[model samples]
Target chain A: MKFKAFLTENGVILLEKRFLPALDKMGKICHLFLTREHAFFLHNLLSGDGVQSIAQFHKEALFDDYRISSQNEDRIAFAIDISLLNRAVRSSVSICSELGGGGSTANRLQIKLVKKLPPNSTLPTPFLTFETKGYKSAVIQDVPISKPLSRTQVLELQTALDMAQDLPQTLVQVPDLNQLQNFVDRMKHVGDLLNVSISKYGDLHVQTSTTLITLGAEFRKLLVIGEQAFAPPEDQTFSAQTRSERAILRGDAQSVQVNVKHFSKSLQCHLAKPDCAFYGIAPQGACLTVIFQFFIPGTRQTDKSISLHCRLPVLDPS
Target chain B: MSSSAVDAEAPDLVCQLDNVQGMVDALSSVRWKRNQDAVIELSEHGIVFIVEETGCLQAKVYLQRELFTQYEFRAHGRPRFGVSLGLFVDCLNSFSVPGHSSFIEIRYPGPDMKLLLKSVDSLDSCIYAEVRTRIPDSISWDYNFEPAGSTPLTFTVKSAALKEAVDDLEWPGSNIQIKLQPAPPAVTFRGEGHGDLQIDLMYYVNTDLLVAFHCDRQVSYRYKYKFLRATTSNIPNSVIKDNRGSKLSIGRGGMLKVQHLVSVARSSTPHPHIDSAGYQQSSRIAYIEFFVKPEEDEDAVND
Candidate 1:
């Protein structure tokens, strides 16, 4: 009926502030499923960041993360106003800091939740409590969650088109966030869509054209993530094999045409994350994927990797 | 004339903090959209940020002297002045550059003084910024709350508990009605908007939440959820870390007061729930208070 947990304060903060806000920008509501070992944020807003955006967390990527007093096979799902969660989290963080939380001193942040209240209905209760034994402080927050969606739909757009032959994209690492900012400024006047062309040699071109003028910036020497990274694990079909082969057979350029606004929004990841990896996913299919990894200075381990797939409406060029 | 003579005003007060991020983070918590400009009052204690919303809601945050490494105060009349909160928050947030050792110094000598902000970056480079000041008006409203015995309702609960309640009921309603009773359903909150929500908190039943309870008579009032939500938005659910949360007071007229201990390093308390301030285990003791006015002239009690 009930379970209590001691989760990492930093993980909770990251969920509330960063991940939730990112989802809110894409849509009004999101579905969060929490299990003993994992938390998943699933949303299908055609996120200007792309077609689908999913942020997941396994316990290891968490800060001193652990689960307690719970039965196996327990999962909770609820639809919530992502923006409201943003505010709720801010409230929790400030309260914790004021009382000397988020430190080694008060190591434990105890959170307990009950599935049913008044001992009857199947519906969950309205509140959850976050407490720390070291400080003997407990924060009981109303779990502002709502009824789950009728059906949890998986919105991953599985495409038959290949990233290597059909897209022939280039991968680039952003050295500075300002560069992305400048790209966005150029995009404002460029038209509704951006034409991103990447050559096999890593010459990445971001081009925008209006009725009168066309602006393009070519970045050279951008480090490309190894081919194996993009290869789908099971079949490993059209990954490093076809990508290098096509470049050698003919000097071909892979380009993906995506909404200028969506591409720019994805670039925003540069502000919160130190490094950004931009991948041109589907040129003809109209999708761009970006993955961000974060490091907190001297921290030994890191957690979840956020992958954003921004899909533009596909066009048939016969 | 030396450069100092050209700017003859020697700053009135100056303060240095080992980390400016903490101070900025403190201010960032109260960045509610409905809030107007704030007044920075300086004294022997430290700086207190006053944020008021439409005159109906007010949150005063007091960051004590112990928070800063270096502190100095010098004023003409009262040690307080007004500034644009947006600009103030921006100046504080500029320390986001990574790996940069942000050694921050803030100063202003006297009235009509340009607020000076100087900081050392990670590379030992110094950055200086100046912002024009707004004239300090006599505190537009009097905060002089009623003295001692006249008070009617008061109790303490974990800030987390109250904040969660406010947050849970925030949606689907423009106004939130709070009903605090002496009976079994000690606290009831109703939210009415696109959809309505009614949640009841039993005094002894919700054991982990209600830290202390004292209610003599049944009292109820309605407030704009937008305004009420702003008060709890910045509160950290657990301020003292011990089970003790924050204090809530309701006067006869429906002016709700929320007092929270923002910082506490001292641990001199047998009952964290009962006492507002106890033995100090927390080095920093910042207290933030919010006064919210209830909706008046209501015909219908239930939506």
Candidate 2:
């Protein structure tokens, strides 16, 4: 099997776009588990970056094509050093710039890889070809891909937010991503928990309070894309909606508590690509699924869009 | 200047400024290399906060008098006192809103008194943070480098290149041997562990790195990697001011001196109180100098 992708002059842009989201925030090292249809990069450590809070970053175009040798549908996992890759690509591209051949329209990267023997003796030597109309250069690096990373305990996601489609929900389109980022930045140190409440009238209220002071931000005229009517649990409440989802639909106000720092860090993805949609659903605990649709820069031919799924875990407010 | 001034004017030294955020950043930068408690020396030149680790490694941040908006030190002699760096930092940051500025009034009320700070945030509310200070015992910490008797070797290096080089050389050994000369092979850094790892960069060959090399005599010394490593992060995070680079100086006893202009932490506003030297004299600009003495092992190679 082979893997490859064409990228712009500076390899860093492509590197951050594809691998940064999939890998954990703090420590970029992760084990890539390949399946028949998609590849899963399982990060064993808690990333300092908000990616950990963002349960996962799911995408379809992980690799152009990653075929398995064992079977058509085989599972193989191998540990990869993301920082090393980041460093190597960074150094290599800088060399191109130092040599006076980079940052020009003629500069481009062509990567091609072939898996090594013994399932994974190590990754095969990858080919790095830097070509311009007048000059061409290449560098070959034998990256060391080792055994799968092992973990003591793994938190199995009880329920994926996307799987609960039947639950009543609402989608809010954030036209300006910077507004949310500014709020998170301001309220980052205010409290431990960031409480987000959504009202039926399409109002979004973000608040955090301490014994000393309380800070809140309100956004009005948020379009409530859609909501389905549902009944509350019989034992939950008689006069009001029975289930939490019903209350959320009726605009009784659905709120969720999450680590402020993580939520703020997770919003960093929006900085790279601002146009995003917030999908909110109220189960026993509320959850936010941010869908980021961004373009792969320098691929002027296709204008193909890449979709990234960042799921945040909502804590049950006591 | 009254010898028996009013009680309000009885402070050993009181400095007022429209902002104390600059001092806050200068204090925080040394935390990476020094101890939680630092000795602040108020002298004729300026105020120096010294952070030392086991007396072998030390970092000094010099806040010249020009940095303060209102400066006056009226004491019979230079006063050296100690306080918890953490508490002092907390006091400095108490009333600061993320990006905006705050007013600060700092005072040291004679010896054996507390370090009192008064600040007013944007809301016009006032807050106070008092940290008890102590008359430090008669422990001598020398702040002088390149003494009167000895000449020093110095060079200018691109900040980014030094950071990259340090990163490449880190973890290879417990100590790093540096060689500088007025001849060819301008700079050489060798880490002798896990197989010999040496990097030789010529002045003209690696012009992107060495930047400028100046030396009157050949100087080679072996400094403890642990001490030298502390300066690693300071390079990359150091904001390149006025397009100038970090300065490196080697003196007698193999004491490595690294001086850089560190941009004040957090605040993006341009520093105030410009100095003719082109080096900014605001809290936004800090003059940081690191001194790492060579390990005193009698058997350190050529020693």
Candidate 3:
């Protein structure tokens, strides 16, 4: 296996300052999946509990020059401590900034996978090394990572990823994150589980209740995503009632009960400064998905280079 | 529904307060410990919250009826309930959004006998909370504080300076001695532990720092430092921000009574009300009082 890449100036700022720090708040360890086309940071994908987060970045978005080779169809996957990775990247950025005096472009940051003898041990260990080269000084940081998964293990992970990618039937855009955060923080004091309901009619209701009291907040007239924006074509009839039809007949919204802590952790994504955010609940789904959308600077176009979302595990109604 | 039916179902007490932040500040001033229970009593004149620490300390927060934008009471008698002090403060704080002064409507005896609070400012979204309340238990200690001498031996000092002096005296000390004398008209606070530290507020030195002084005779008493500290520890920033003064008076048997007045009016504009004389005035204020018993071992010294 071989992997090496030179991070662009924008990559250093985004990775070291925005992405990694936000991911660090979600979980301790993150799975770094490297493919020929893109890189994926997966959290709690293999675990059965906790909030699962996936952050995807295209090769050109971060890497100036990228190369990777492995037996598993040129795909490499390994787990590493999120904080350790963040620290290494942060140190590299600081070193560059110090040498360049404000323009990190003067320093070159290269990350590569290598095998070397770790200090206080004779046996060699696999490590991800970050090398920062300036005019006359160089700094290297070694961060230990889990051994690469075998071909079969990689296949299993791919299957899991495919299952998690299943999108909800309807998506609705939520309000400003700062407002939502303030509301959620207050709900946290009321109960452990938050009931989130989203309607195709662009209505969002969040509530928390205990045996002693019930608290709720409602946001109406939100923007519904495409196709689901209006009622399904009247001509298309079905043998059985669809989820949306059931919702309409019942005069209720699709609701999911999730841990408040998990929901709050996902809200930390506001640090990434997404252009907009959407919330959706899959039909008979066990998780509530929150997608953060980023747009290209100075344009109305969505930036397809980066995609980030979080899936919060739902609690059993009983 | 008939008008009579609607009246029967209406809450016993309904009030609206636009300055939620001011109420939050007053309640938080008495919240020294987590999970503390405060007994709330509602009367036609105002609402009172009584929190006590067994036999050592007691605090009362009085919110006058004038503090609210509208106060309506139809109950036959005073209604009392008990609630968690910390939770009450936190719930009120949520209604106050930063940079936006939200109006909150408070009602007692919600459908389930709970306290109902609703934010009535924004049209897009409405936030409502119901807090659980229990039957209030009988108060444990009630001490009538009569003047210790012919004249009330009281002294008033800037809240900020008083808080600073009390905080600075917290150095391995278990008890703090308060001394007041008419000669030269000065008040002294001495804490003795590893060493001795004394802070004196004299009438003639800086009138601004020592706002008021009154003493007919010399009086000295020692109080538990912990209980004394609780009085000034949580004086809300709003009080200090307005440059208010806290008055400390000594009653019979060396009981120390600390009083602070918190204005429960919007910072930008005060709530205007018409008096019987047809004059407009702002009378929105909350009174907070703390009564601490002096140490039993230390006898009071009077000359």
Each candidate's number of clashing pairs is 33, 5, 0
Best by DockQ: 3
10 residues in a row with least lDDT, candidate 1 chain A: A155-164
Q: How close is candidate 3 to the true structure, as a TM-score?
A: 0.89
- Angstrom error of the Cα, residue A139, model 2: value is 47
Interface RMSD of each: 20.5, 18.9, 11.1
What local distance difference test score does each model get?
A: 0.57, 0.55, 0.82
> What TM-score, over all chains together, does every model reach?
0.45, 0.46, 0.89
What docking tier does model 1 reach?
A: incorrect
Per-residue lDDT value at A69 in model 2: 38
Please tell me the interface RMSD, in Å, for model 1. Answer: 20.5
Residues A151-256 of candidate 1 have per-residue lDDT tens digits of 3222211111112123325555554556555545444543566666555455455555443223344454456754322322331222222333344345445566
lDDT by residue (A158-189, candidate 3, tens digit) is 78787888787778887888888877887687
TM-score of chain A of each: 0.67, 0.61, 0.90
Off by over 4 Å in 3: A98-106, A226-251, B1-8, B192-195, B267-284
Quote the positional error of residue B234 for candidate 1 in Å. 3.3
Q: Score the docking of each candidate (DockQ).
A: 0.01, 0.02, 0.29
